[model samples]
Target: MQLNYSIEGGDFTNAGNASSQVKKILKKLNVDPKITRRVVVALYEAEVNVAAHAYRGEIIVDINTERIRVVLKDEGPGIESIENAMTEGFSTASAEVRQMGFGAGMGLPNINKNADELNIKSDVGVGTELEIITKLK
Candidate 1:
């Protein structure tokens, strides 16, 4: 199955919408609870990252019998350094974002921990893209 979702930056009210929908679909498909949890965790982290940092974003999800792949792309001030961004407790979120309690700097770390395979690319002035993959079988 394939699914797509759009995200508006600074829209915390709906930051988890895509992840929530995917969780429901995984449950209905009888996916293993543990795997589902991992996927959801990774997805939620990515989703929130876009909402907190990007100008706008898109999430594309593909699910098959063997695995699931999620691609998150956004238009915003991209990361200056993926290495720094991946570090725990490292973030460049605006003060306003921090005030909302959404930028604890754990997003990438959590996603990395939960995804079986992860890839990230960014252009400092362009945006960022993240691909998270997890095995289903």
Candidate 2:
């Protein structure tokens, strides 16, 4: 199965909407709860990142019998250093974002922890692309 979702930056009210929908679908499909949890965590983190940092974003989710893959593409002030961004507590979030109790900088780290595999690419003035995959078996 495949699913697609769009995200608007600075839209805190709906940051996790895509993740929530995916979670519901996974549960109904009888995907293992543990695996479901991992997918949800990774997806939620990615979703929040786009909402907090991008002008807009798109998420594509693909599910097969063996694994699940999610691709997130966002248009915004791209990360200048993926290395630094990956560090725990590293954040570029605005004061307004921080005030909302989001953007604590754990987004990428948590996604890395939950995803079996992750790939990221970014351009300093362009945007970012992230691919997160998890084995179902």
Candidate 3:
């Protein structure tokens, strides 16, 4: 199955909408609980990243018998240094964002930990794209 979702930057109220909907879809499909949990974690973090940093973004999800793949692409000031950005406790979120309790610097790390395969590509002034993959097992 395939699904898509749109996100608006700085929209805290709707930040987790895509993730929540994906979780429901997984549950309805009777996916494994552990896999579902991990997917939710990764998906939520990815969604939040777009909301916290991008001007706008979209999420595309593909699911098959063996694995699930999610692509999150956003229009924003992309990460300057992906290496540094991936570090735990490192973030570029604004003060207002931090004050909202969304940018704790754990988003990427958490997604990395939960996703079986995580790939991120970013352009400094353009945008960022993340691909998170997980096996159904």
Model 1: lDDT of residue 81: 86
* Model 1 poorest ten-residue lDDT run: 94-103
lDDT of 3 by residue, 1-137 (tens): 99999999988899888889989999999999899999998999998899999999999999998999999999999999988888999998999999989788998989999999999999988999999999986
lDDT of each: 0.94, 0.94, 0.93
Cα lDDT tens digits, model 1, 1-137, are 89999999989999999999999999999999999999999999999999998999999999999999999999999999899989999998889888888788999999999999999999988999999999997
Per-structure clash totals for the candidates: 0, 0, 0
Alpha-carbon TM-score of each model against the true structure = 0.97, 0.97, 0.98
Candidate 2: count of backbone clashes, pairs at least 3 residues apart or interchain: 0
lDDT of 3: 0.93
lDDT of 2 at 97: 88
Question: Model 2, 103: alpha-carbon shift in Å?
Answer: 1.7
lDDT of 2 by residue, 1-137 (tens): 99999999988789899999999999999999999999999999999899999999999999999999999999988999899889999998889889988879898999999999999999877899999999998
Pairs with steric clashes in candidate 3 = none
lDDT of 2 at 64: 95
- The regions of model 1 sitting more than 4 angstroms off are none
Clashes of 3: 0
